[model samples]
Target: MDAHFARVLADEQDDAPTPGASAAPPASSSRAAPTAALSQQQLDALVARADAQELDQLDARSLRTLVQALERRVRSNALARAKHADAPERFLESELALHSELARWRHVAAAPAALLPELAALNAAPLLLGLFAHDNADIRLDVLALLAELTDAEDDLADADALAARRVWVRALLEHRLLPLVVTSLEQLDSAPGVEDQDEEAAGVYHALQILENVADLEPPACAQLCATTVVLRQLLRQVAAARRFSANKLYASEVLSILLQSGAAPRAHFMAGTVATGTATAPRDDSDSSKRRKQAGAGDLLDRLLQAIAPYRKRNPASEDEEELVENLVNALCSVLLLPAAQMHFRRLEGLELALRCLKDRAQYVFSGALRMLDLALMGDARNCARLVEVGGLKALFAVFMGKKKAKKPTATATATTTRRAKSEAKAKEEELTMSILSSLCALLSPAAAHDVFDRFHAKFVENDMEKLDRVVDVFVKYLGRVEQRDLAGDDDSDDDDDNDEKDENEDARYLRRLDAGLFTLQRATHVLAHLCASSRKLRAYVLVKLHEHRIDMDVLAQILKEQLAMLRGGDSDSDGDGDGDKDVTDTDGERAKMQAQRTLLVHLLSTLQAPTSDAASSAVEPKQEEAKHET
Candidate 1:
């Protein structure tokens, strides 16, 4: 055939297919053949029309016809170009334009399920693969998004689902000669220039990270290979480290680090450590959302593994504040896991309180709270292992929360008064309940020093500023302490009267009653704080009056304290404030003010204990105390 005739037939063949429809046969029954050859001038004309530089210049019908014709030409040319050992530069450019146009036209066309796979087959060539990492952020983004979407779908195991697509993508990334290109794309996007395009760069990094995150499930060997490469991974690590300082970038870096750790790529643990370091910073960059997302994603699991791997560092003195922060973050993360129902059970059986004790000593606020919470869980839930925790100073640290000088190295200076008060109050509540619970659990197991320490801590709070709080604290201690003393006193009573059975029973019973009376006195002291509470402020008096009316203190003590108050009030002495001399201290002024503050502080504590739902014995015993106080009043 002559070149002109062949060219005409090729044009007609290209015009046969329509967008979103299968190709229709032309008037002639034969399939139109390819152009034998084309002159440079003719090829250039076809190329210009294919470029469609000016859409308005063409008629609507002609534009439609041209698109159909170019679509066919693109498919044919792409195949030919794939096989051509030395495709011309112009042809290669035309191939890229056609591929980009095909991508755009996909939505317009009724894209068969097979279209992407077919395109991928063509594009996976060495020549086309380079375009995947092109400089145009939009092009790179679309390609990646398309690939990710195609891979993310669910179909049959052998189908074109996310798993299948991921496999193909990983295979190409690992076995293809395009590894350098992939690495360069990652780095380029990480340090990409221009603010106008930063979002795109971040997106590209995110896509790569998503793929990396699943590398273990999809391609463990490839993930290991990626980590094995010091040069490539080091840059990725550095990017992650830098990202932790920027709210906008930290998530992407954290995602990548999480993947590395999840896959057990030990080499990449340095990056995870770096992230932990950033998370624990005393003044970490205010990337709260990003940092939180990082933690939410997989940081907990990564942290657990990282800690287990380098436990030797637990005792190593940190090199700097940053290093300490990193250690603190790691401990926080591990303790969080330990508090999980499963981890709590696992560690309790494994005697994990030893490690937890170390965490309590860290002095970081978050770490301390986490350790304390886990210790409580262990003591409350694992009776067999409770002794182990008691042996380690868990009880002491908890008591310290209620009694010790607040950590001198406060985390921040600009805290609000309400926030500081509420925090201390919460710590106080936890400390009290934990102290009582621990003591009860270790009635005989406790060493003398530990028992004394518990008493000392309880005493300290009593003597400190807030006596009303001190009183309730002492009540909790007394409740448990009384039980211990009664048991001991009864034992002594039994030993004293050996053969006198009836007499011994009576004596022991009376001794038990005496111990119960002592127990009631502790409750009385605590209830007595309520009288001081009423005397200090009218608001406190009103609230305490309300609480007194609600749960009347034991009738005997109430009558006694009330009789004391009635005598003092009837005397009309100027000693109402309870601070003595009726010469009110400026810090302790105003009847209603003192009452309001005292009422708030008292109610604050009363409400917490009520909510806590302590041992049934403690709750049931409080009623008699309330009734006694009621009668005295």
Candidate 2:
């Protein structure tokens, strides 16, 4: 191949004359060239030779010639296929041949900039889009493949000029109204009979979706163009609704919906209003009246639909990994929507908390993690949700998961060790996260006025006569705080170890740090819950203080934890941070900081209340003063 390329370059060089003699070919040669244009037979032979092995030997000019020829053949073949449209098989065969030639063109025309002009000259966007209406599904699929190649962003191109040229070509394709057509084609293919007869429909949908995703990823103008074509959003939502559990179409549709929703192109009111009528194939209504209606309905409707979509998977085991992921995504969508006030109201109305509670029992960690997060959001500041949660026995359920005893205990003797230690580590991390979420939910519930009765009920169940449950709660706080204290005492010794530590030791240290962080979070939440209880109910405070004194629970530990947290908030040394563990920004660090401040404030209030005189003590002193006054009289 190298020799052939060299020989061709040499022949061109030999035909060239010195610059002073002539810059152009001789007039006699030019006249003969026009008359000696290749015949159809000669063109076929040339294409066959290039297709076999000579394509790589072509120079830039020869490559352009080959690409142009292939483009012309594609056009001619499409025309021929249309002419024989009555013979479906023959049309398909010709379409396949056309796609093969285009694929070859894409291969040899490695410089995308070189072939783009030829494609533009052929009006390739419309030509390819036109095939989408063909009766043969295979032909439509082939057209999609070609279009994907043509519109693909040339990321492999290193030169700025080439990349800009590719972008311009893409913009041209978009300008030619390719997005609307792609949407329309997907809608048609989705409704086509026997779409499942082959993989053609799926392939076409995948490519169509890819094109839309790519367009959406372009500059704001291109995204606007895509968003303006409202049919795509409507179709995508319908596809998402119709897709079976764990289907690829469902996953892609969800992803596209997320992108669209996040783009700020689709009005949140529209999604919130539940305006997407299921199975409706019409274009989206984006007018002021529609927006007004969406506002009137609010996000409640959307929250309802999301809840319904995810409700079925609440307790059921997923059939596959994909199904689990789909469930998690749906739950996440639910959580995102629940951020709205209206959605939170509707969530309680729709029994969303119950669904979340059921999901908390799911074997898939992601599914339950999402549920835990949603519960956290729903209970954040919504008193009505807290009341509903208590009504549904959510408090007990949370305690069950928090204590890891909802299901029967498995004795350690019967446990089997696994080879994958990482899996075990991950499981433990998830368990900690779950515990953290449960504590967060409890804290949220404890903060609301409506939750006072719920707290009373919890106290009656766990703290009334049985000190065991109460002690357990106290134990969680002390256990983590003690760990922090121990780590702090050993900090100086570990400083030298940190420098000499191997990778495995470093990893172990990191894990220990993470565990320490989780512990501090847990301790903070425990303190918050205790503070709330003490501030809300005097009798509860008296009972807790008595228990603390009886059990010799170190009030100093609570003070120490508060001091460390306060120091961290003030940007103190790493050694003075929570549990004396170094601080790194984790996802919930900001939230944790805020919670710690609130906990500190609450702790101050509780300590003041505990030390202040009780009503009985004041009344007793007043009685003695009154008797003394009577004796003096």
Candidate 3:
């Protein structure tokens, strides 16, 4: 027999039942007894029997019995190795075998929960963690892989007991302080020279990082612990800072950092302060205290790092889908940091807004959306940022896109008819979204203090460009409202159809409704910008009124929207006062009610501003009377 079988047989013989105590089952028996309550001796004998018969020949029951036996044997062997430190090679072999068996078992079903808690118990955690320092790189990799499996909480087990059992394993991992061990192993692996081949090293690193991610996902406190650790934070920062652009590690590091920052796990102020202190060497003023200087410097450095990470992608789009995702995560991290006042200052100083503007011009929708969002956040309640935006001619650049001068795409002539249509539809949708984003940014720029000057700048630009920008905004508003009206009319009609046709019609109607909803949202944002323009400047208001008078269709569109909104408000108020389905959807209608109120307010503001006489009109009228007096003289 094979040497592996010989050892199994020896162990089985040592613990086998006495011949007089119990009889062995007949070989002809089709169904074997369940092994859920098997003792150690019985399990060992089962393993011996499996070795003799070979795993492939075993029936389902026999295979399950062998798996239970292997779990018990691996547990006992790991414990023995932990108790007797002298036999390192023996312990290594046992661990290797256990990992192999576990991998096999994972292919069949969820891991037996008993396996992890046994390995992670006080006695076994140290032994299992010791594998990180094993002489063999492959062994260390295996240990990392096994731990990753042990800590994973994403397995979709339907059985409540299995899920509870899995949670037990996760708790054991946390209770035994395995997270710190995982971090330590990652640090060592990253610092150590090439252990095996390139693939092996990469695999090891990937598994280790995955373990950290899983821990963070399962336990918030563990994530907090990681964030609080200076060494770990530094290491993660280095990974992000030093990683080759668009590399997997860079993406992973960005994701981990995003989680840390967004979860409030790390003390944002402390981390920001640390970055500033380390990255700069400027001495504080004589009156400034060391703690204050440290904090200011840290906030600056943190902002600088985030911008630097985002800077690379401005000139170059991501090379792969993963890198694209990394760009999003990096942008989110930048946005989170920009929430700090100190960080916002650093952002402006670093010309972060310029980078975002450049990204907004990128072809990728996600990059553009992220950049637009960042710009919106930066400009919110910060007049300085709004000034900077105007200083950089951001207004002109955004207006170019807003006016549809910057075509999103030009389809190739070689495409099929359907493909061309789809491409055009996608391009049109993107154009709409981009226009809305620009309008949103413009709205953010129109704070009470900055509104006057910002409006003046826009008015000058509109006149210089022959009022094309204003015309574009008006046209978009009319077009979207018309589409919304068309959808409402179409929704009021019903046509009967066969089941299949009904389903298809329902799907098409659903898609059309979504488009209609998006168009209405765009209309709302455009109206907001129009309202701001009119409210802030009398000249712009006069121009809008003149344009509306010339385009009766546009005037009617705005009037219809206002009238419908007023009717809806009246209906909702009456419903609230009455008992007619008043309580049925009170919670659901609150948001719709608020939105209608805002739209009504903007419409009212636009109308009032347009009706008020401008200084230009008054001056022109006075000049004509002066001419009449001169003629009389």
Per-candidate RMSD vs. true structure? 23.2, 14.7, 12.5
Worst 10 residues of 3 by lDDT: 624-633
In the range 323-405, model 1's lDDT, one tens digit per residue, is 44554444443443432334444454333566556655544434455455556555543344554554444545554554553
Please give the ranking of all candidate structures by TM-score, highest first, separated by commas. Answer: 3, 2, 1
Q: What is the lDDT of every predicted structure here?
A: 0.44, 0.55, 0.57
lDDT tens digits, residue span 1-633, model 3: 124533653565644333332212211112212322357447656764665546444444544564465556556555745653563433433543554454443332244543444433324444456656654455566678767776666663555665565566566666666767777777777777753335555666677777777776666556656656645555556556623444566678778777766655144444555555555532222224634653444534655556656666666666677977888787877776665555566567656777777776655444665676687667654657776777676875566566655545344557888998997776665566556645644553544346335534544554454666777777776677677767756654543343587776686557556655657667755665665555555656667768766656544445455455456557766666575653233433553455446545655655554345445653332221111211100
Which scores better on lDDT, 1 or 3? 3
Root-mean-square deviation of candidate 2: 14.7
Model 1, residue 329: C-alpha shift (Å): 9.3
Candidate 2 C-alpha lDDT tens digits along 1-633: 224433543565644333332112122222112332256347656766767575655455665576566566667656655564453333333443555565565553354564565555555555556666655455566567666665556463566665566666667777677877788878888897765454657777888887776666554345445655555555666665623435677777666666655554233334555533321111112334644543444333444445556666665555676766666666655665565555676667556787788777644534665677788778765667766776677766666666665442222343566534555555544554555545545544443245435544544444433545555566666665565556655654545445544855675556557546646566765655554444445555565677667657655545555455555445532323545343332322444455556545655654554345445653332221111211100
Q: Give me the runs in candidate 2 sitting further than 4 Å from their true place.
A: 1-49, 52-101, 105-139, 146-181, 211-237, 240-246, 254-270, 273-305, 361-369, 408-416, 419-432, 435-442, 445-455, 458-469, 479-520, 538-633
TM of each candidate vs. truth: 0.33, 0.60, 0.62
- Ranking of candidates on lDDT, top first: 3, 2, 1
